[model samples]
Target: MDHDHVRDVDPAVADALEGELERQRSTLQMIASENHVSRAVVDAQGSVLTNKYAEGYPGSRYYGGCEYADEVEQLAIDRAAELFGAEHVNVQPHSGTQANQAVYFAMLEPGDRILSLDLTHGGHLSHGHPANFVGQLYEVEQYEVDAETGYIDYDGLEEQAAEFDPDIVVSGYSAYPRDIDWERIQDVADDVDALHLADIAHITGLVAAGVHSSPVGIADFVTGSTHKTIRAGRGGIVMCDEEYADDVDAAVFPGGQGGPLMHNVAGKAVGFEEALQPEFEEYAEQTVANAKALGETLADEGFSLVSGGTDNHLVLVDLRESHPDTSGGDAEVALEEAGIVLNGNTVPGETRSAFDPSGIRAGTPALTTRGFDEDDCRKVGELIARVIDAPDDEAVKAEVREEVEALCAANPLYEDD
Candidate 1:
């Protein structure tokens, strides 16, 4: 964690980088699927392995002299498999979307019926949004959450599955704030003879740390981002039972993507090992606790949290209900001006576009990594409240900025590692 011992980075770049660190320390990071990687993981990502362009799988590389890279890559693949109890893992996909694509290519034929969570409700773009090829190439059916509770009604999902009788069922979300019923999806899959894919991209790290229930043992397919909750670099991973091992591998290699990111693969390996550590579990637990605290504080401040509150890292704060003047886009800019970082997102029934969503999607995983606790979360909620309640008031924004600076001065990002 000490900068004095670190030698690889340039002094000027390091100074510039330190400013970003100061920004992180000063502001709160609430992006649901973001986290700070450990020093070890960062080192692994920056290792000499980046020099190689080793294409193809370990023992079967197109280029020679990939023996060592092969070992590092295999370490990631095998360890990831162990960590998630996955019979097979392809740690090669460029991201969670790419990982999802692999599965779709492997299983569903063009025009095959595929059921997924409706995007506006709680789904990723890769989950067959009409604009995406999945919808154009495949017959896609969407299921929505309950109109009242903002939770997915298992009955409604089943009814859709029965009606569609699709070839694959996607169960996951990007903005959703509760745990999913993987077993129930599996049951529905059985009823429809569909392949069930659970994209736990947001909760993958929590699941790995045992702080959250995982879809590994229950679902036929699992896809995730190594960066999000796992806190590695930008990349994706796919895992499945032995039954789909060969198909998944072939789909990822020849089906979805071309060359593998060997350096990032090495990085994923490091992160997977880090997740196996004991303290990582503690970090995940605190991440959720901080999220709950932030959610409670926000609610207490008169904001309406979608699903009433969060059971995970992120919360969908429907600002329309409280601060009708501020759209998600307005709040996003307002908060950014006050030194806070978060994304504007669509709510369950969001009428706004993604560029100007109706809700602000906030979470605590990244802030908790900076050693923030519940008290910090509450103060962050207050800071966010000020910005949302008075988006145009420069004085309020300045005051919130000062409070954020004080909070950052206390935490001091990347100082503890």
Candidate 2:
């Protein structure tokens, strides 16, 4: 963890790196889409592989001196295939958004119609949000979760697909807490003769560990982030049946990106190898259990959860009913002051702006990574409730900050460093 080399070159950048390391060690990271990667993975990501420029897949690279780069990239692709049981896996895209872009580039042309879940109801920007390039390039329509149950309205989605006759139907989500019915969505797409793209960016680890349903075989295309619950380094993956392998590989390379980030591919290979071990399964299970405990505790404290509770590693808390005067943005700032870090998210029927939404989404992947259990998460939940109840009270914030410090001490992160 010592950045002596960086310090020798640039003291300011070294100081900033050290500051961020300290910040993560001190604060609780509850952001659902994040996790702490292992030191091995970090080392691999920061390896000499960063100097290589392997442009094409495995053996057919556009650059020379790519022998080690080919080995690392092949290991990543093979490990990912084994982890997800995917017929084909492309580990080149820089991020989850690019993974989705690869699918679109392989399958659809500009102006093709897309059907996806609404963002406020737990969808992502790459699924055709107005601000993204996909939205401008394609004709997009969105579906929503049921108003009463806080789950996907499958019947409604089918009806919409029939009406819109879209070229591609996108499934999966970002903030929604419940498990998805991938088969049902796939069937709807089948009926419309549309391609199914399931973006499992948030729950890739859960799906890989068999805790949640997978879309690798059911959907025509499956995309995910390598980091999140998977605890890999920062990157993206695309999976599909072998029939679409060439199209996907081509799209990910020359279509969207030039040379691959070989350092990240090495990180992915190391992380995937780690995940193949038995303990990673235990970690994945504990992560979901901790989320359930957190949601139950929050509900007991009168916070309204989006789906009443969670089945995965995240809980979406709708703050409108519990604290009528407080906005999610307000709660976010207050909780961060108390050393708990998570994001303000939008709810199903959002009345507020997306920037300062009405809900907060908390997850247990990072907490569980730090060896937190159900009891610890419940205590964290209680701490969150206290801060939301008295967001402006300096006394309450100081008390909560002290407790957070104690928790961090008990569950030390990067202790060797």
Candidate 3:
């Protein structure tokens, strides 16, 4: 869409870009946290709003000439608030992690206890990773999904809540593949006199489209990424109860970040407005359907799925029986050779290092956005099976890559308008 920039790119770079586009059009993108937004979102992200320096909210910016920037940002906040049914929204935090940071600053003190799902058990890094500020400043206790069923243990969580008496109970996941029973977590938080938060970063689009349950009313604070299923620009939002509105606003501005990314905010506004359309609901539903189909097909091919399978848009493949000598590390490389890009993830009790694990995570949002569905997803499963069956054979990888190209030709990304 930004033709001038594309033209300025070196010839090799341009060719590589074209090739990448071809690959994206062809292969399956089953990464749950990735999606394809419309040209409107792209345009707004590249707009002149990026030049502004609006340090504060509309009608009260820290700098002048932010009149239009303030208008667009406020519209984004209002639209997102309406979409998620939240009483307050802040479309500032540069990423989901920062959104969490602002919430912590607004509500809790340092060293407050935070009860969250364990990272390997489907929790995100910012929730309580030792390397992150969260683990350094707060007392962190983790809850786990039932190893056998791969689901949350509400009873166990309540017991821990009673024992830990944490100050915050955060309900969310990066890869559990099950719907969160946020109401139960809310109850546990209330019994323990803790604030409840939901990090709905991965499922915000599904939540917005009404295909999945939302935590707007259930949790006191909700954090999410605009780029994930929300299909917005690369940024984050923090939504909360009306009572915490000022606290959240001040925390984001003076307490955490400064000089907001006005261009990204404009893009978020366009993305939120697009999300409010009826077609967006259809897109979310289709993405879930594609994910389910892909998961079932892969399972039928004798690949064991982590947590059985996903209830949402991602599936984690356990590569034990398929490649006993290799981890998801090797499998991911093999798949990449075939033009499929996804990340290897650590499944529960994984013995391998964090960089190279036993499981590969895949999802459907991007491919579904490109209009691929059940039939196309099944074919991708077959291709993945082929690649896994011969992870080291260059010929096999090349052959599957060709197949991927053919499949992509059938469903090009961004069909000509």
Candidate 4:
């Protein structure tokens, strides 16, 4: 899309928009929580629906002229319900964090206890980090991953739950590489007579496409970001049984967010339609396969991987053992300079601070979207090893950057534009 109207109205904003588009076209987005949505999704998000102020659910809006808005929101909800086998789905959450907030607002009282995974152990900030509102408003306790195994310590979590008697148990993660056992976590919550909120923000698409186990029926509440693995634009969704439908809807609307982002809801409808296609399953499967290949390549090069590998679209590499001199931030900067874009992440038993942690998390969702296969990801892994092995070497960075350009060309993104 040329966005000629935008250029005519505002030159500076137009240039920035064009620059952002070019950046996406050229860079490899390896952030586990990020993905490349289809062109249709982008168009839908940029549509006229943004002008509407649909402050409530479909067929019942707080504003007028919502017929089209109702249509779009209903379609999004229907598609998501089908995709997840959820008894009820709320597509109005502004983000995954808001989705979590909806659950909290619906069920928990002020100062209620929350048991969640630690941020440094692959948990999200919304899951009771001190910097967030939930931490201040609620009593929070955190569990850790098994430092030696790089997996969730289920036994430890259960013990903690027993001791703490939390009001709710939060599962799912941001940087975790292993597949989550929803049933295990649910059992713990059950034993404690607590609720379970599984935030599958990072694996929404994998769950929908059956590439990973779903937490829909297993957990009491499930939440996710529509833009991440789901490729359904930038928003949040909540799923639960019919009994919690009204409560979830109320919590998401007047309780947490005001007017829904109707344009993004349109984008969700379009993207969810695309996800239902047979090819999406293949894309989801290939994403996991590519991650495995990338992790295997890095492991072969003597890089230490959390959990020793991945069963999903991402892998977390602990740099402390493999590259003691380099921090995750250092490797991340050097890698970005060499044209590979991912994040510096915290690992279990982290020694450094979160801002400059000791781990790097890489995912294959965007690469696979660009038509990259396992072989291509292996090559990418080799480049990563080289750059991290000698982050200060200009010659190596230049060489790798050239290769990155070639790879981008071969697996072209937005080529028509």
The TM-score values for the models, in the order shown, are: 0.94, 0.99, 0.95, 0.99
Rate residue 191 of model 4 by lDDT: 99
Compose the digit string of candidate 3's lDDT tens values, residues 1-417. Answer: 324477586767777777766656667666668887788887899889878899988899878888798799889999998899889999988999999989888888999999998887789998988989999999999988776676788999999999999999998778877777889899999999999989999988999999888888999999999988888888999999889999999999989999999889988999999899999999889878877888899899989887787777888887775667878888888898898877788777667877888888888888888788889888888888888888989999999989888777787777773
Give per-residue lDDT, candidate 1, residue 331. Answer: 95
In candidate 4, position 385 carries an lDDT of 97
Better candidate number, 3 or 4, judged by lDDT: 4
Q: In candidate 1, what are the lDDT values of residues 1-417, reduced to their tens digit?
A: 434434365676667666766666677777787777877777788778888877788899889999998999899988888788888888999999999999999988898988999887879899999888787889888999885798999998898899889999999789888888889999999998898999999998888888778899799999999998787777999999888988998998878877787778888998888888888899889888988999999999999988898888888898787987789999999999998999988888787887898899998888888888999999999899989988999999999999888887787766755
The 10 consecutive residues of candidate 1 with the worst lDDT sum are 1-10
Q: Candidate 4's error at 149, in angstroms?
A: 0.3
Clashing pairs in 2: none
Predictions in order: lDDT: 0.86, 0.94, 0.86, 0.94
The sequence of per-residue lDDT tens digits that candidate 2 reaches over residues 165-228 is: 9999999899989999999999999999999999999999998898998998899999999999
**Best first by TM-score, ranked:** 2, 4, 3, 1
What lDDT is obtained when candidate 2 is compared to the true structure? 0.94
| Candidate 3 collision pairs | 26-408, 30-362, 30-363, 31-363
| lDDT top scorer | 2
